[model samples]
Target: MTDGPTHYPPPGAPLPEEPEPPRAMTGGTRPPGPPAGGPPPPPTPWAPYAPQGGGGPAPQPGYLLGAAHKPGAFPLRPLTLGMIYDGAFRLIRFNPKATVGAAVLVTAVAMAIPIVITAVLTFTVGLAIDASGDVESEISTADAAGLVAAYGSLLLSIVLAQIGVIFVTGMVAHVARAAAVGRRMSLGEAWAATHGKRWRLLGLTLLINTVFLVLFVVYVVLWVLVVVVSPGPWPIVAWGLITVPAMICLSAWLWTRLYYLPVPPLMLEDVGVFGALGRSWTLTSRQFWRTFGIGLLTVIIGSIAGSMLSSPASFIGQIAAFALPEYAALLLVLTQAFALVVQNAFYAPFLAAVSSVQYLDLRMRKEAFDVELLREAGIVS
Candidate 1:
């Protein structure tokens, strides 16, 4: 948390003048000088609103903390923790509550497919393993193998289920955003934006996760080696201490960017995954520290909340597994399925939405989003 200076211009000061035109060819072609004062090119339209520092907006307290921005540069505006909390509220404001609810519902339904698949597989495999007949006999090894296969199938089914959830969530977010802003959008309107580009998005996501996963595995392996080869328990203790926090921080950082990877260009420029990623990187690069800091904060907050819910369920689950293996197995399978469903239900829309909002903010910074917003609001007229 390095601090930076924060500065703002006096509100009443007229924005600085435009640079003077090149000295009119010094006596050569002075013929075309502006029609003897015909309204001076309408004041460049954007000039009057520019901040004295040349950025579009004045910084507030805690914005940049101790940093000064030059005129005509992008400034990091104050982003309070309250703004994020309010973003959830904004979802309802921008669209009817029903829209967000519908998105969540669709996500839940999409998630259920995998759970159902898992439950059916578990039940069938479990029953088959416990059966004894001339036609169908099961050895312990055979039963174990079948169970493993069933689990594999369940994992595969979940991947497909998640993809479906992704599409539905993106569509829902699109419609919600448009509707929130009083724009008309159909189900097709949402689908139309990303329909043909699904594979590309998937591939891009795979690439990113792959990179992170590989790095993670390498980190884990190195830590394990250190522990095994260590002379004492100090190495193990130190590794655990560092790895736990690092993993937590890593997960949070990833989640924040996950929501925005393709959002800016997808919503604004209408580009596909790769283009959107490139564009997002460009916009985010300028404000890396702010982006990373805010993202880490969100993750930490969410992790705390998630841990509260998951920890108790985990202990209860462990007790059930030991007390009643067969019934507990079924319950465990069911619980896993349900968890998947819930995750898909909420994650897709939430990610899509935050990305959309961040896209709006990015455009405001880079392209003067406020100007467009004012125009749309009829404030500029």
Candidate 2:
């Protein structure tokens, strides 16, 4: 493992700002071929992709990143489904602080806006609905506005949650990429790297949401056409049975192809939103089933696992509510929030890990990536 007293830059030092020729994986530069019996470290997740640097005896940009170091989590070569799963777990276990800890922080912050908004509305509006449905309170303008504000907050929370997922996935992806190279990112480094690309990632998130919305609008139009043309129980049933399932399939296909693994490219390559989109789409080509299978299974497993963890809290919350009915509303809100937090603590990071690993795996398989001069790049110790 030792590169012969190579005097590798000690681990934990600041990564060099100037581009190492081999470290830049995007230019006319050719990487020194793969190390004997090993793959190269992946391209550093943080690099300037704005323009190619020129030659003046100084190094140029664009090099193959190697995953060749004794993998902190996963090997650099093409990976199997089980290996990807194993690597995600290994990453969480080996780098708990950056993985689980960062996940917790992101979840809490993201949830905070909704939680606080709900709490204020609940206390101020005083639980607008009566569980028994016996109240006949007359409506007031203030109450109506409060109701609108409450629902608006709910909608805002949904948007925030999606943004949170994207942000945290990118953050965890940054750490996971480093781990793939036998390195762990400190919390500070993770934030610095991920936050630097926040606006670009946010723009991507917005674009993705808009795409899904367009799909929804299409589905609605088709449904309207079916209803107007056929207007029968059978036609309705056919729409439900055929149209719905087809739409679901389309969404799944699009998820795996278009937006699933763009974070690493956005971070590793100096691309704007559209560039990352195209890069991710290209990387996932011809591996549709493999990527889809892995992603679908991961989501299913994460859901089951999250439910198992969250169930206990919910059950206990119900029990507590029965024991103290006076505080039922407050108790229910807290319980739901806690359950969500519990679920996200593990699921979000796991998904992000799979994403980062797969991104590198694809690079190795499709682009022939290999790391040659990691020490010279100022990060191999």
Candidate 3:
């Protein structure tokens, strides 16, 4: 180093001056070019591709619905028939006297349609028979049976149509509860929801009931043919062995397939009739037995309740030696209709609510539907 300073020919020739001590690299006085030794900086934090908001995200219906899919997931916690009882109890608890009063009011309003129809049809036919009686002075057995059968069929159809409407109303109640946020729903909200989907619901009921009615007609035809062609006990035996099971199975299959066949999805998704049918079929296919048992139980219970409600009218008719048989029959018919409506009231919301719950369950199980639901609810970015 000393020799380089003494023997340097010129300032630019051979003077090195110990290479400038390698130029220390500090944060403030670091070299302008590459650093001597330094590790790369850490990468940035992960930022979700989500829109910014005050809250992280809000809960979605789909995600809340997803809770139904887990191994023992019940849309209503502590699930059982008791749940239905509890729900109905809640309806009354809100306004003790008013709730029962409202149910009675609605029931009375609904019953008037059928009651009027029955009374008018009875009087018209009675008058016709009376007019014919003047010519013969006696009613033939065959004519009497024919009149009774025809009237029964007419009344049956009317009853079914009214019952179908009540089911539709119940469905609307379930949908309202499902779509609610932050709180449970009341009958008023349920009625509001019912009103919105009333037309669509009635249309669905008509389509499904029409199919069932056609099947009933076929069953009737076969029964009549058996009677006409083979009056022997063997025809009865054969039908019992073959037709009964077939009818039962067919009814069960159809009932299970269409059980929850239309509802929240129809309301929520705005699906057409066939699409709702298809979705219901898909959802119930795997759990047919469970559905069947549930349906069978419902029917049995409903029948029992309906019978209890209706038993009084039948007993009264048999006991009373009334001067006017027609008036007595009218009383029985009205009582039966009122009882049926009450029995129906219990099962209506149960079926509708369960179906809606099962619909969401299917979506959750098959698709990662919780994700979509969360996205919709704004809970997930």
Candidate 4:
């Protein structure tokens, strides 16, 4: 060994130590003291708090936030009943041409078809009754058959009206969904979106209506039994007092639970009728009272609005009827038609918008659908 350079430590000189690694300054560039202001440090966007009871991690700072801060047709959060109501009106206000025009077109067709069928059936039945001589005389077999045919035609017209309602509802729902996310959809666009789905929507409506019809028939049968087959008055009175009310309550409850549940999935998810129903049932689970209360409130509000709009037409009709008694029947028909058109135009969109908002609200609470909606709107990456 060559003892290179013969280097040695000087006497009393401390051995050089490795330089200490730099410390991470808690507050960069500031003295080791509290921040200058009394206000707390801003929260770290990445920092997460533990949930209470150690259930789960708390939501991240921006995770639950909605798409944009700007107010749209719907707020970027879970909706209140009031918000839903307001949103419904806002949708109508935002897109009257789509909402009102679609409703009017569909409702006019629905009303016209039924009215024409009913009129023709009535005229035919009246002629037959007249041919049978005295109108108030006992019913003959032909007259009975004619009456049955007329009533059956009327029933069919009613069914067609229901189908038309389903079509209009689907159309309006599409428009409402577009409006909710700050989009404007034309009536044609809405109809096109719902074009292939109307039959399925109609099927769903028929299914629901059938359920209601069955309940009504069962109620009527029970009532008949209570009146005709019961031994005494107390039973009839008891049945009327208890069973009827119970059935009515049950029907109302079921209606509230189901009425708006399927619209969202049907329109947005593009699901089949039965699939939509199942999805709706799943979404509505454990939230029956909330959904029911919102639905009932929406119905009452829409009904009041429709009544108010239609009342003016009715009042004017009454005035005309009194002023021109000879043309009273004609005025009555025209005015009633006008009222129906007005009611349908105004209330159809309103009900559809309410249902759309309710559906969106339900999905947000259950599925965090706001995130999805925001993402789709490109508000969130």
Candidate 5:
């Protein structure tokens, strides 16, 4: 966002010239310098970089190779909206082990153990309660143990599922980055990328959602207070007239314009949590609407695609439940879990790929990162 170069020189750039020796202010003694400009150090390799007024790097003609230069998921240029979506799918195809595969693996592991344990405990407990004749009798220790295990396992599954999604997103983000320049990482390699950063990423993901949720709860509570304390219909009118509109406006402004934009920076740029938040904020400046629109579109697309992929199982489950009420509960739970796994597997990586491409696309457009990436890919001579 500054008027200076937004990037450091590329990897092979020469070091900057050393500063002149300090001159004492006590006397007018000048420091000796380069022997009357005797051929300055080979003009540093960064010579090719041109800095635009707003931190953009110089153009590299070598990168104009068009499709020939695109070795990865999408072309190595500023992307159109459709290209972003296309890039997401291409990344999945190119690196399934790191994207959808990882997602499915994590979701299955996260859901499987807990669901089985919870189901068994709940079923056995239900049978015990049924045979206990008096419905009002105090719960036995065995019943309490079963209930505790059932509830705890369900709660544990949710936590694991959330953590797994976050970790998978982190892996997918890097996969998108590597794919931009024709790099491929194995499943273990992608998992290794998040070795020390998962907790930080999780904290960041929670911070954004938690802040928005607190704000929403506050708005609803205020309306409830107004309705309860006020002795007239004015509070009801105000709730409709003010509270809902205010909540929607505030949430939309914060969530739509900036949701999850920071995750890529945290993952790819290796910035701290707050640093990533600041980076995303600056990157989206003057480009908010484009990013927001792309994000909204991806959500719609992913939702439709996920539903299409997962809905059949759900419909079948409902039908089976109705047709065989005796086994309905177990059948429903198993079918719903399968449907969720199918949906989560598809959605997580798809959304992450879009977000990663959007981040890279923004960088390329604003700071000539495409030139850097082109050079990294050896496309730019």
Candidate 6:
């Protein structure tokens, strides 16, 4: 072929162009087509090779490099116990003005109204009782009637206070729910959410209290029967040995199963009293132990915190009493009230947050609430 295109070109001549190789063998290997033995392997779609160790795809960077993902107010995944507690505190921290401020305002108003009413009634009744000036041994019918009226007024005040508690709890539940969905609420907005639901919450509270009261009465009757009607010391001892522990266990169980659980669905879902109760019962059915454990832990923590705060407040109150001996009683009452308000400021939101988080967690376990929340937030398709 013309001396095979000259093994070497003349020293000054431009290098001759090399002939093109076959297209199939261009890269020093034949282009892939059919397997050697079998019909062409089913056409395999091109795909990137997996990383060597078979791990998941690399994680995406967050808003800041190396930062953990923050989907919303909380992580967009099922929560752990620690996460629940953390979320509770975070809810308060995220909107302390709404959560803590509202609690303080509501509690102050609630407590103040009842205190004023009771004080007025007590003052009026005391004046009447002193004016009568009845002998101690022979009490007049008017004095007895006045005493009954005073006691009735006290009972009414207590009921009103309980209703106020229900209202405050409903308001806090609304705030907690809003916080869960990454929304900040104002006190007015929370109040609006709770406005129509107050009566229902109060009814639920009354119903639960009535049930507990009935149970307590029955227990007391049983104890009386065991102690008085039974023939011997052995029966009383046996009753004490068995019923005391049993009642303690029962009370603990009831507290864990029912307390604060219905409030979330009641306020969030706009469910009625009985419906909320049913919802709570259903949600807690299979998760009793977990719920109980979490409730116990939260109560312990709250108790410890309350003790820590209240102790200092009590000490300060004692010091105030000593400093202002002439107004010792007044100072003691004012300081105690101040301390109570402060304690409620922290505890109320904390308890509400715990209840709201627990409600979300239960829904997540049973109904994949995290997915629903993500979908609602437009984080997932």
Output the number of the TM-score-best candidate.
Answer: 5
lDDT digits (tens) for residues 202-261 of candidate 4: 778879889899989988887887789889899888878888678878987778666567
What lDDT tens digits, residue by residue, belong to model 6 across residues 42-139? 44333345577887344323323211213445565667898888888887887786677876665565445434543453344331222233212133
Each candidate's TM vs. the true structure?
0.57, 0.71, 0.54, 0.69, 0.75, 0.71
After superposing candidate 2 on the true structure, give the runs of residues whose Cα lies further than 4 Å from its correct spot.
1-69, 113-158, 231-245, 372-381
Q: State which candidate, 1 or 3, has the greater TM-score.
A: 1
In model 6, which runs have C-alpha deviations exceeding 4 angstroms? 1-50, 53-70, 111-163
User: Which portions of model 3 miss their true places by more than 4 Å?
Assistant: 1-105, 113-164, 167-176, 179-182, 186-188, 222-240, 310-341, 357-381
For residue 299, give model 1's deviation from the true position in Å: 2.4
Candidate 4: Cα lDDT at 11: 22
| Clash list (residue pairs), candidate 6 | none
Q: Each candidate: what lDDT?
A: 0.53, 0.71, 0.53, 0.69, 0.76, 0.66
Residues 179-276, model 3: lDDT tens digits: 42113445465556555566667677778889999999999998988888886988788887998999988987897788444565566665766777
Query: lDDT tens string, model 1, 1-381?
Result: 334424454223344453544332343434343777575533222223557767644544532222222111112232244543355345544443333454455545554554565456556655232222211224566556655655665577566666665565456445534532335455456668666666766776677778788878988898889978999998789888988898877765664454444643554466776676677677776766666665555445545554554456556655665565554545555555555544443444454555455555556667775455544533344
Q: Candidate 4 regions off by >4 Å?
A: 1-71, 109-163
* Candidate 3 positional error at 259, Å: 4.3
- lDDT per residue (tens digit) for residues 232-266 in model 2: 78978977998788999999988988868777898
Deviation from native of the Cα of residue 333 in model 5, angstroms: 2.3
| Per-residue alpha-carbon lDDT of candidate 5 for residues 157-264, written as tens digits (9 for 90 to 100) | 657876898899899888999999889988999999888788899899889989988887887787788888888997689668876777777676686545658888
RMSD of 5: 16.1
TM-score of 2: 0.71
Q: Could you tell me the lDDT of residue 145 within candidate 6?
A: 54
TM-score of model number 3: 0.54
Candidate 6 RMSD computed on C-alpha atoms after optimal superposition onto the true structure: 16.5
